[model samples]
Target chain A: MGELLLMKGNEAIGEAAIRAGCQAYFAYPITPQNELGEYLARRMPEESRVFLQAESEVAAINMVYGAAGAGARAMTSSSSPGISLKQEGISYIAAAELPCVIVNMVRGGPGLGSIQPAQSDYFQATKGGGHGDYRLIVFGPSTIQELVDLTGLAFELADKYRNPVMILGDGALGQMMEPVEFPAMDEVTLPLKPWATTGMKGRPQNVINSLHLDPEDLDRHNAHLQEKYRAIARQEVRYELENQDADYFLVAYGTTARVARNAMHKAQGEGHRVGLIRPVTLWPFPDAAFAKVLDRARAFLTVEMSAGQMVEDVRLAVNGRAPVHFYGRTGGVIPSQQEIYEALIKIIQGGEKA
Target chain B: MTILVGAFGSGKTEIALNLALRMAAEGNVSLVDLDVVTPYFRSRDQKEALARHGVRVITPEPRVAQADLPSIPSGMEKVLGSEEGKVIIDVGGDTMGARVLGSLRRLLPRRHSLLFVVNPFRPFTATVEKTVTELRRIEDTVHLRVTGLIANSNLGPRTTWETLLTGHEKVLAAGRQLKLPVIFGTYPCFLNGNGVRSNLDLPLMPLQLFMFPP
Candidate 1:
């Protein structure tokens, strides 16, 4: 029974960051997500918190790196191409094991694509857009409420693993309004970063850097990062399963998950046994959610706002146990519920190749 | 003609859409989607539903409708010129959104009502000062004074009678300071008869729009 308020997904992220005690927020303006920065711009000053609109996305992420390394809860947000600009900085932060939250309100893109919502950044997020021997924990929430909840959780997990965490959203979720109950500010407790590069006062000096020029040193760092990722994969896999015992399962995440759930209900109304497996955390991929219904799964159909992105992960998770199919609308177009339902019907009829 | 403009997420599109539906009963109505600041949740997305209600939906060209460009649709002058019907312009949120109205100022009907829709729950309009400031900014950007205030404040699905009442009080205070009339407060249609419809002192409009994707 926290105070509930109507909020756009972008604005919710800003409030969540502030409530999470994010000491610094840096970002450049981009459509679909501009409201987020705008929200923070006004609120941060009121809170006496650091909110800087950096000159570019690259500068913004690097600023986040500085703030995070100094032991402040830091974050930045951007759409697709801007996110691409932040890749190298993200990689540096990942290697340095800095705790920070990055929000990607994804827009359609190979370049400066349309400002319309799209989940085409699947590979860019979960698979490491930046050059790396590292993985960032990425959460794709379907609703503004979930986006708020995950924004709080993202800061916690980022600190828990001392790793960068990303909230992967899109223009639809960013721009749409929904009722959200944010966590009470007093309930938030930030973890202390002993490894932070805070100036030492007679304590051991600390230095934070990403470069490991020595091959052996880099190998050891990579192994440690891998171990942390394994632990995350073990404990951080999050998803929602509905009608798990149904014949056909729809695998989707973010806004596409909502559309798929509607299609699932539509198919159910027609006496078709369709289910949904919505991955909240895209990187971990929620393989166990697939396992929950694999026994009853006739097949798994992956839906996305891109041509086919998360479908590859769904295929990997199903691992040939069930035929994994994909249906998507790319270039900023949202796949309608009817389109998804029709795709499911085709798959059920064995008319479409898996 | 009545035009709705306000802070982002202050329920402009919702109120505008609902207002258009209500006005359609009286005569022909046209809901113009003037939002070019954001990429989703514009009123034009409900063109099919509004059309069914006999309210004509005006938006950018069909091909560029999905594109987030500042280009205004061509037939607005004809629609705005018509005195046989009502036109409700669902302007985008904030001063940035209000900029689109600048180019259309010449086409605006002389008797048009510019209403500043306010939801005090939104961060930008959370305070009386902030709400008045944002409304004035919109006025400056569009070069049109807001004639009245529409207190359509709610926390979406989680809106409670308490939420609506408190938001209404803020909007009322803002209206008093601006010397503008508080036209009415809006409650979601689902909350109709749950007490807010009859209990609130101000005239209340029932909103049936949630703008969800199918």
Candidate 2:
């Protein structure tokens, strides 16, 4: 029988990957997450799984790429800079349309930003961490629940769509301890990866490549990706929230969302009508869902650790129907519920019109 | 150079391992174990092993640093003069073990780095000032300036984000008083003793496991 254990967001992601039937894992050591690697390194060996503590994040990501091409459940993880090194490979994986999961336990950014909890990577994860016309099915885990749940979803969606899925987290989620339950997956096996690189000796070879020398072929590939993206956009938008009897909505995700939820309750008891609308799938953007809620009556505020990155998304979602407002503090700093509620109340009462 | 300090069962080894691996990423680095007091997961335990990644662990030559007592080793003075590469020094838990560094004042680097691995939720959190005073006193005696802090606060497997945040504020302010940077922070994981470390990147050092039950 599989055992139940308490884990941080990082460790949960590692365990979830294992349960998703991923046997090959590679990564370099980074903060807030060494426990994840060490846990897997120590345990996987007993299961006869492949776990390599590569030289660098770069090496680790490429190792995942190689394994994914073989049609296996493969994954890698890193923080800001380390993830930066792996972006080139991430884009390549997307271009090839290969299935894999990339976990980014986000920290502060823009060149060695302080390693603290931050949601600044919202854009990086949803808009494609690296360069290219691609999008990662990004899932922002606000609690250990999402860390385990979304991690499994990341693998499933990546395989279902033959694209990369990202588990966007922060230092808080990765470092903080929590009681978590891991479910068994033997009763629910994922479909076999017939598109793998497990070798094509006796049968027709399966080529996994992102390159196209011919202009027509490249155009066709681009068109195919566009069509697939559109399909994903239509079917994959996801979000979560507690629409309590409140006029003001708090938009946030990842660990910040949980903080916002607590902050909302505290604000509510103080006689403020505040609720939360947290995004679970950031890449799909959940535009329709949020836009539909624009009729709920009042200003919407985006609170984050970054300087109004995701607020732009909120603004785009609300369009002109409701006035979109924002407040943020970055570089490992988080705003308090009082601060968020104050901002929300200020926006609602400020009478600033769109 | 980096300095490691923390309490018993506070995740110092994890932090050291994270720091050592970070050093190994770029070029050559060294993890010198000054903790003759601890039983397992000492810098000495994994020093030679770091060579696999270009990091070299500095061991005491004359074995003066080999003593289990809370005293300084003669070899450290020699280490300060050499400008070979990055170095991480792991010290014992308290002022007693930290007292040994008084003799190695000439060895501590300037502006490069130093860290006081703090797990604030432990028995030390009774008073913020008390903890700060003790840490500062240790720094004063060691002659090593603490340039940064690594909050490895936890409540064993029951630790929560709130506990981490609560402890972080105190330790962070303490480190801030010395104008030291809080480079990154670490939290405890509930993985079985055999589970993986963690997946977040924050220029961190995870907890070290004691092999001999010290």
Candidate 3:
């Protein structure tokens, strides 16, 4: 909300979590994401911070589950595989309906893959990584500012929706330096967490488990979460970009969206009407933004670091009203300006009115 | 057999492709293009050429090879476990490129070698310490060990012995710090020896991938 300072995307998430009144952070170090843990490790202790580098990704997420069950703004983070390890704990956090933040600075892979910046984790984050029919509000921040601001917003929404929120990052943003303004200390007085485990001094034995034995009881729990998700779909949606006037929309998310922004300007410079639509929140996707574009554009290109994971969502948004094109650079490879330009050129030539 | 690493314009593709050809000539070897970090010029780009030489090239199908899919080929462990003579994996540049292999490290054989190809003219090329750190980071992510160093310094088609020597000296120093052995410096050439005319320490590796890219 103020002047920005130069910062990495991962560090921005770390600072934003603190400002959002997050009481604790538990994390495990991995490439492209070690900086995030390092940032929190440095800052959390200065203000009597509650930060711990749990032995593994599983342990770190479980710790967040513990903290959030106590009704605290808690967080944990890892890259792709580490996030995979965090699946079980996340499901519990989601089921318990606690407010918590999860930061995933994604790298290439389904397994112990490369440490390059990749958006391959889209489905895992948006569709829910854990088991038993659950969903988390996943936010895709394309810049250092969003990385910071998104964390604060994530805490707010997790409480508002009674769900888990994740700031999905990649190595490029995690490692890259940029200008960002740190939030003022006074502005970060977090709302009281009624579910927090503050020593159980004033209440009965406080429990934070996700075990519901009775079929009817679990069914009610599932139904309540479904209603909450429906509410979130209607209420919490965010997107950004400056190409509403253009005939073609370039849709991208996370760091790939930053590349798309550059591609948009480049296309404009080359006498093409290319605009970009960047979804800030992956889950509760900015469907309305694309819905507006469906009537205006001939086709929408979903640019990502992986193939067409979000393309399906674009199709739903357009609902076959406008064609959806998929253009992506996979693994940790960031597509160059030329590559994106080529995709635009193809779309212009192929999707044009003959 | 060998993996190449360097910045853009560095002759990694050439060296890796040529090494695969040589290894394949010796036996039924496969050259897998792990160059998921670079979208074009991949060692697997010359799959037809490898096919011509009785070498198998594995490129993931277009669907799974999407922009955001993890490029680790499923069941890669089985393939590496069956390596008879050589299997060359041409990795892409820096930590970004090397990391693709890191995820598949658990699948890599312990006897396999990882080559950190160096070009002295590239940015951040002044020190071996930088090389060591990058290799360490790559090793950490993939959990694989770096076995050797490749001093592959060349200025496009006009490369020479002098440039190769300079690149070699820098790499040797860096290798010393990294505690890695110099596998070899590459020599790119065409008919009449008109390409990469370089003479350096260790065995000279003739590269063939410079000319092939999609």
lDDT of 1 by residue, A1-354 (tens): 376677888999999998889989997998879989989998899999999999999999999999999999999999999999999999999999999999999998879888888999999899999997789999999998899989999999999999999999998889888877877777777787889888998789899999899999999999999999999999999999998779999998999998899999999999999989999999988989987888768998999999888999999889999899989898888899999999999999999889
Residue A173, candidate 3: C-alpha displacement in angstroms: 0.4
Residue A210 local lDDT, model 3: 84
Sort by lDDT, best first: what order?
1, 3, 2
* Predicted complex 1: CAPRI docking category: medium
Say which candidate scores most in lDDT: 1
**lDDT to native, each model:** 0.88, 0.71, 0.74
lDDT by residue for model 2 (A220-305), tens: 99899889888888988888757644677888887778667877777778787777888888888878767656667476778888
Q: What CA root-mean-square deviation does each model show from the true structure?
A: 2.9, 15.0, 11.0
Task: Assess candidate 2 and give its lDDT.
Answer: 0.71
TM-score of chain A of each: 0.99, 0.95, 0.94
Question: DockQ: which is higher, 1 or 3?
Answer: 1
The candidate scoring highest on DockQ is 1
- Cα error of candidate 3 at position A193, Å: 2.8
Per-residue C-alpha lDDT of model 2 across residues B107-175, encoded as one tens digit per residue = 565645667777665433324675676577777767766666787766555666665566667667766
- Higher-lDDT candidate of 1 and 3: 1
Global lDDT for candidate 3? Answer: 0.74
